[model samples]
Target chain A: MTAFLRRRSLLQGLAGGAFVLVAPRALADLGSRLDAALAERFGERRPEQGGVELELSRLVENGNSVAVTVRASPDEPTPAALHLFMPRNPEPWGTSFQVAPPALAEFSTRIRLAGTQDVMAVAEWADGRLGATAVSVMVTLGACADDLYLEF
Target chain B: MRRALLLLWLLLALPGHAEPRAGQISGYHLLGEELQALQDDDFANPGMLWVDRGQRAWDAAAGASGTSCRDCHGGPERMQGLATQLPRWNSDQERLENLEGLIRNCRSARQQAEPPAYESDEMLALTTVIAHQSRGLPLAVAVDGPAADAFAAGRDAFARRRGQLDLSCADCHDRHAGARLRGETISAGMINGFPLYRLTWEGMGSRQRMIRWCNEAVRAEPLQPDTAKALALELFLAWRSRGLELESPAIRR
Candidate 1:
């Protein structure tokens, strides 16, 4: 009975430890971890997609470089920080911008998409509410990892 | 005296300036809203990827001296405003040297390192790091003094029409900067972003690469990136960007 109890305790500890280890990583990688990452950046409150206008082209000849713009509606409350995300990129979050009032609530930047994928941006307002939106981009040629072996 | 200077400036631009006292437009304004947003976003900006690589190269040691860039340059923050004054006159060599030329010189002379190819990854990485230092600093270049002759040469080149299309740099950039060409807005050829991350390349490339692409776009035989003519044109662009802020590691489509 004691042996069985010891083995059960050991398995319980291992399972708990696995949850601790895997949980953060599961939040780290992008596939769907965006919600978790957003929670970490903003808060636990989920954001509804609206109030934010994320703009870009529907198709790009090359995936290497593409332009994106994120803007809050003129009437919408200004956001505190703006962050962009690429769901399928090697790294999902591209970057963030801090908005200081009473400045224009508009922001723009350029980003690379891994492939034909959707790009998103979230604007966290001063009150902690978030306005989110996503744009679809099609890249013909994705970013290249320079083959240094061939060059050298 | 100010009026006299203005008259001279007017005369200088008259050959191609289409309008009197034509103001210059920075590349930032010429971009569509989508592009501007991408530039402002730090995380998704593909250019930052190059900047990160550059940060690594700066820390790594190279050359026969076994020294890294940090050993001599101190820190990147110290380099702020450095690029604003580049493509200047090097009186010691009596030549005009752009950022890349000076980079090659530094590698060969200071580090005793084999200089990188004109637009190699190492070269682009290092250049991007250096340029990132000058981010947000206003463009500033001395077109007079020892740089005068080169600036004049650059100005001459800007006005000289070439290529199979019979177009000069001035024809598009200076005269019709805001005009749309086949749906693309034309921008003044500003060199504020020397080592920019371009979408077409999907990686970092030097200002020389961008210039060469424009040269080819006009069906002109592009000058070598390291060539004297190219440096002279670079000087003109630097002078052109006098008041604009530097957005090195800038993103472009």
Candidate 2:
């Protein structure tokens, strides 16, 4: 009876240790899944770093959809296209806007957030390089986790 | 005979000119003291505390230059009537500038300081004081000339549909104005009273913030606070209610 009790205690301790080690790996795996989804959609087109401005709140009260704006930097010629992506969202590639040249480098729209995550935008310049900016938003309320929909 | 017929036609037009909606247009009148009491209550109201904090920040100095708003505008009282004609076309910048932008510009150019964040308390306070100055004046936002393109763009944005819920601005305010939504009567999408004190928001929020809230409430996503489309809609709403008197710090359910 004493030997059996000691074995049970040892098994419980091993199980606890395994949980602590595996939980973080699972989350990292989920994150990589999101990144993989985004990469698959974006393909070989790597987003560049200058001439685009992305504006968003550093903190979001709700993550259902946070307002986002992507504009061409004033110095750059107006961008012909702009793309937005949320790496952690179920659907990573969200929306793209086709802009007219000489258009104000300013566009505003909203996007869904899966959780507290980095939201990135890439602006395709008139010249081929894509400019980008990213902001991490602390989302207190997760995105529409439940399937409830309200109709107006 | 011709003159008599003309006289009859003129008489017919007279009755039509008489106020058709006179009976329905009742005015709420209170005595001067009563109105003053209401205004005082407004000032001391807990809702105004946000504005009060803004007032304090407006006078406080910050940034690398360490200059306060008092350095330029000489404080709130002197800066009245400033907010009424905002979002005006700035010739120097060659773009439409809002109150927040103007505050930042003032800090950058006059104070040699970095502009406060877009929604910072300092910006709100300076703007509140400016809006306070134009308190009783009618709203008169210009919608023509170079602003016409922006106005058209804004109107388009208001009409556009996107987001998971697939809703538009008109679906609520325009179509359902005055209808009760969750115990509150929806007022017309009027911009007459802005920087308003809302029991729901519990703070003074601009029309732009309200616009963003509407988007979120409908689960239709939201645009950035400084987005051009939102600004354009703001311009359009300001123009729509051009002759309405400004009612800043107003109480709303």
Candidate 3:
């Protein structure tokens, strides 16, 4: 059954015409869609990749509920808010939290992933600067609102 | 004749393959690091939500009697080591009954209230609280005397091949354990983690629901919930899990 799913995903990738050289164009489109959503929220401030740390498994067995943690480095400016995004998900915006002053810019929560996609986190500092990071998570099996049993 | 009796005694004392302890393995060790961490973290484990609900249900009074589980049985802590003996013979019902069945019986017979339907949130919550009490206790279900027939039936069910895939529960969980089945590793079909929170289900589930899912996966006709057959299978699974610590409300993929 696992082989069947792997074969099916490979076939899907091939059909998307990427020749397995890179990600399918559909995925690329979703990446841009994420960028657009991020732009709409953060507005012209391109979030950098190193200011904040996003902890997640590179490969997850089930995508239903995955534990994730985000922490802003101490050297970096204090973060005022944090936002999470998943491009391939039905909703590009995962969630957001406002960090009160004197509180640590670190938080942990569980989120659902759509499939093999990038999970991005953005942190807004008190100085109006934005820092972000994204991790590529390969969901072995996509379980976002999935049915429990398969009908033969 | 005395020598023959001595030989029978030795055979009876021998540790047979049916004893789960011989090669027993909990599903927890088979989990990936992430899931293991999740299960270990009481705050982060999603299954705790059900346990909390169960706790509430245990104290809240219901039915004509207005007696809560706590009023009679005190706290869930008092029920320690109780779950390990369940799916046992119920002389009142004159049939085998699991923890859920016992809960249902209490509700209808003692509390004078309609029992919650099988798989209902109320049922799952109540069962979780009781089973959670037995966490870390090894399964030690007795399958002798009046319970022997059900145990034999459960063993047969575990080995019986059904479904379109033509696979028995033992075929994958026993013979092919440790082998990769798709993205996941197959572990011995243990039931210690049940009433667990499964990522695939994204919610709490009873052992019967998990069994039904397995039956469906194999394309076999699932046994109806709360039936004699289902209880028999539960007995078999609990007995097969002998010596394995219970991890109720466990987090699983």
Q: Which candidate wins on TM-score?
A: 3
What do the candidate models score in CA lDDT, each in turn? 0.74, 0.63, 0.82
Per-model DockQ: 0.09, 0.01, 0.25
lDDT of 2 by residue, B23-57 (tens): 11101111122222333476454436656776787
Model 3 in CAPRI terms: which quality? acceptable
Per-prediction share of native contacts kept: 0.18, 0.00, 0.39
Ranking by DockQ: 3, 1, 2
Worst 10 residues of 1 chain B by lDDT: B1-10
Tens-place lDDT per residue, model 1, A2-118, is: 999999999999999999999867545554656656666666686777878888788764455666788886678777877888877877778888879787768766576777777
Listed in order, each prediction's TM-score against the native is 0.62, 0.51, 0.86
For model 3, how does the per-residue alpha-carbon lDDT over A1-152 read when each residue is reduced to its tens digit? 69999999888978776655556666679978898888888888878777888999999878888889988877887789888998988888998888987788889998998888889989888777888899999998531213646321
Candidate 1 residue-wise lDDT, B19-90, digit = tens? 422545456654445666667888876778778887898888888989888899877677788888888888
**Top candidate (DockQ):** 3
lDDT of 3 by residue, B1-253 (tens): 5345334433442434444444456778766778988899888788898889999999999899998889899999998888989889987677998888889889998888889888788998999889999999998899999999999999999989998989998877666655567677666788899889888877888889888888887878998877888888889988888888999988888
Model 2 chain A: lowest-lDDT 10 consecutive positions: A143-152
> What is residue B168's positional error in candidate 2, in angstroms?
1.9
Q: Candidate 3's error at B93, in angstroms?
A: 2.1
Which lDDT value does model 2 have at A56?
A: 80
Q: Quick one: ranking by TM-score, best first? A: 3, 1, 2
Q: How many pairs of residues collide in each model?
A: 19, 4, 1
